[model samples]
Target: MNDEGAVTGRRGTRITSGSGRGLRGAGEAAKNAWRRGTGNRMVRRTGLVATMIVVAVGGIFAGLLVAGDTQADVGPFAARFSLTPSVSGDTDVQIPPLGSLGLDSHDGPAHLTVRLDTLDQDRTFALASDANGLAAASQTAAADLRHGVILLVERSIVAGLLGSLLLSALVFRNWRRVLASLGIAAVTLTATGAAAAITFKPSSIEEPTYNGLLANAPAVIGDARRIADQFSEYRDQLQRMVNNISKVYSTFSSLPVYEASPDTIRVLHVSDLHLNPAAWAVISAVVKQYDIDVVVDTGDINDWGSQLESSFADSIGSLDVPYVYVRGNHDSAVTAAAVAAEPNAVVLDNQSVTVAGLRIAGIGDPRFTPDKEADRKGGSVPEQLNASGSQLAATIAAAGTPVDIALVHDPASAGPLNGTVPLVLAGHRHAREVSFMPPVLERPETRLMVGGSTGGAGLRGLEGEEPTPLEMSVLYLDRTPALQAYDEITVGGSGTAEVTIRRHLAAGDAPGEPASPAPSAPDVESASPDPGTQASPLTSRPGVTTSSPRGN
Candidate 1:
């Protein structure tokens, strides 16, 4: 019995030892699996943070690079200028290929022609410059343009980055999600940039590309400071070119404002002067030739509405006829002040004025920056203009002053008053258009006449591929104070001096007789001709019978 008990105790001890060994092996396996899982999680987290950092940094850099490149690609103004350091003391400035501004590397301003959409021919401004002057002016203009382009590029890049960040904040709820998304975006952008670089590798690497007329030109190593100094001096000189243009226009004048008869009254309509001093000459000539008793100017007389531009008002004051004015989207209180100071000027903002037995009411645009809103795009009528139209209509209705003519700068603003008045005159479109109000709108005979740019887009017109034309209208009224007939004049450059004159009968049903045509040989009609072409003789008299449509 004692031997059997010892054997059973030994067996029990062996069983207990084997169970303890098995438990130890299972515990080691569990610890190894946990370590592997934890290690993978840590690796993934580290990689994600690194990716986010790279994406954020690379995206910003790529954005800036693209902005700079785009800015550098577009040259400012119509002309491209190149300045090179010559062995001689004078710098060699070349204006490659001629442009609308009539900029030539060899020919000076004496031979420069200004092609406008307003004139019948390419008009010449007595710029009166030599080789030295041209070189100096080109240098200055190039510098100013370069500075402007740099500021534009920097602003664009900053705006883009800020917009992206704002958009991300709005889209992402959590900080981690934002970071992750930004990392992904950065990776995508980097890949795109790499592909672009491979496709269009730059050929030149000697110098950095710059914006403006001085593009692709080599840097002047030794005389960089001198070149910079020249820019400052030439900037003033370049401004003189504008002044010179103004002076040339100032020299032209008409005979005098007069009426053909007591039963008939003639008026000159102009708009969108935009600070082109040359407009004075056109105005003077038109007034004299048409025997205009009054002149109606629909706003935008000045471009920036600054006090400095007020001097152009001197031309308006010089017009012998009654100058009736209204404010436009481009005009400001400063412009109003300037126009008010004119001896013959009458500024009518939400007010009425009498000229030649006709009551004229006017309204100013509501928004100073008409181009800021989305409605201003695609040549669609601006919302502010619609609002202004409502305001004008309300003003006219409240006064109940029998406004014969409603004057506003924007045609959109004039819509509300279209059927309420015999004539609604506006100017913002820079193109002449006549639209007759439908009978359903209340008055079937009411007409809206939109004038082209009278200032011919002023200095602003010369900046782009196409310049606005010089345009104005001559209206004839009989004893009834109703529009009898009108002439639409468009003057501009098209390989020669070109003038397009369209005449139309009154759309209104007021009592009146067809007035006689514009006086024979109006001096202003044939003022500026092309270099070699003969000035067109003003032979046809306006107010003649025509079957032309009343509106476009």
Candidate 2:
């Protein structure tokens, strides 16, 4: 009986142990499966995040394409760019920045004209001079723009949908989620648009009118002439943009190339207008083409700083960029007042202003011509320049802040400022010249730059036996706030009003030194060897290259 009981117990123990081993193996297998499944889900989630990022970035690119094709209605103008299939079915498409402008006439309805000059074709038509006329033009332009944007959208969307479908089928093995993913992207984009709408503000630029100025004019034609004089800058820009579209495209390669540096600043230096209306057109073109940050006028804005010449203020006021003006010997109190009145103009004489993170200080010329008389009749130009320079230098010192640039009209005036500032820019000489002053006993080298007559020396340029060519300077600075180089541009002298660019390097700056290293005062010199100095047809030069009239 005892033997039988022991054998039975052993058999029961073996059965229980086998059952426990099987349960343990099953649990371990289940745990391994769970881990594999979790890893797969995590990978899917990561892919979704990546897709979201790609969609967002792609959406931004699409938005830019739409914006580039669309043009918002400014008060008097409507612009739109279009690319459509030609009737000939040729793929060689030349889509220019084409647009139209409206001009309102007295008592007559406003007229809308087509901008066909973009195709090298000149066609002009008239429209009514009324709000309805402008509205009609705006609607037309907007329709074309919308059509262009829609075409782009259709192409992008169709391609994206097809790609998404294929990717879904191949990756997830589920086609329905393709639509679901698209819906999610669309919702995200919609939310972004809603946020933008909530924060958008209407532009404050209003249509300019001259009702008061015309009211007091002597005759309708005379007033019209006066109005044209004041509004020529805007007209020139618009007309040139339309008619010269081909030229712009051809010369596109000549345009300034900008690098991605927040510290670098581009300056357009123009001076010695001497009441040349065409100067505005040239300066405006350079400003827009080069993406200039600020315009520095070292004085001599008018031939004689008289009240009659004050009308030139209209041109100065019309500039869309910041205008920093200093009084030249030819300027008077009335001239200064005219500049000060312009909302866009800043009178920098005996004052300083910070622009694009750089401190700029300017001093007015010593001589002021209230009437149409010259102030340098008896006193020497040099003496007057010295006096003004001394006073300005003293003022800057008292301020106890170092100025990056000092602006004056006379190059001689720049001498006193040597070692006090990094760069000194002047323009009274009516010829372009650059000089590098070596460091003196305790001061650093100062770079002096002079701009030629932006107006080609005004009427005097045409009167003299010879005329000066229209010239201007574009200054380039690096992240070190150190002068890198400059381009001296000359436009139209004897033949076609072609543009010529000459590049010059800073005198002492290494050929290609890194701007991040410790900076020292840079030396300056004309990029080219001195084409032996000659007397400028319009003004006496203090040893600088001369040019001839630019008749554009």
What is the C-alpha lDDT profile of model 1 across 1-552, one tens digit per residue? 444223335545433555667899999999999999999999988976665555454545444444422222112233222221112111122232211221212211111111111211111121123435444545665565555444543443453354345445555456775656565654544453344335432232223333222331223123444544443333333233222221221111221223335577788899998876556766776676556889999889876555546778888767788899998776778779988998998998788877878898998876554224433553544666787778778888898777888898877776677567888888888877776665443454667778889877665454444445678988878777777677776555422234445555564323223222233222222233244543222422533211111110
Cα lDDT, model 2, residue 325? 87
TM-score against native, each model: 0.49, 0.47
Q: Pick the candidate with the highest TM-score.
A: 1
Candidate 1 local Cα displacement, residue 330, angstroms: 1.2
- The digit string of per-residue lDDT tens for model 2 on 395-477 reads 88999988888999888888778888988999977777776655666787787788898877765555433446678887778
TM-score: model 2 vs. ground truth:
0.47
lDDT of each: 0.57, 0.58
Best by lDDT: 2
| Cα misplacement distance, residue 191 of candidate 2 (Å) | 94
Candidate 1: minimum summed lDDT over ten consecutive residues — where? 107-116
Q: Quote the lDDT for 33 in model 2.
A: 94
For model 1, how many clashes? Answer: 14
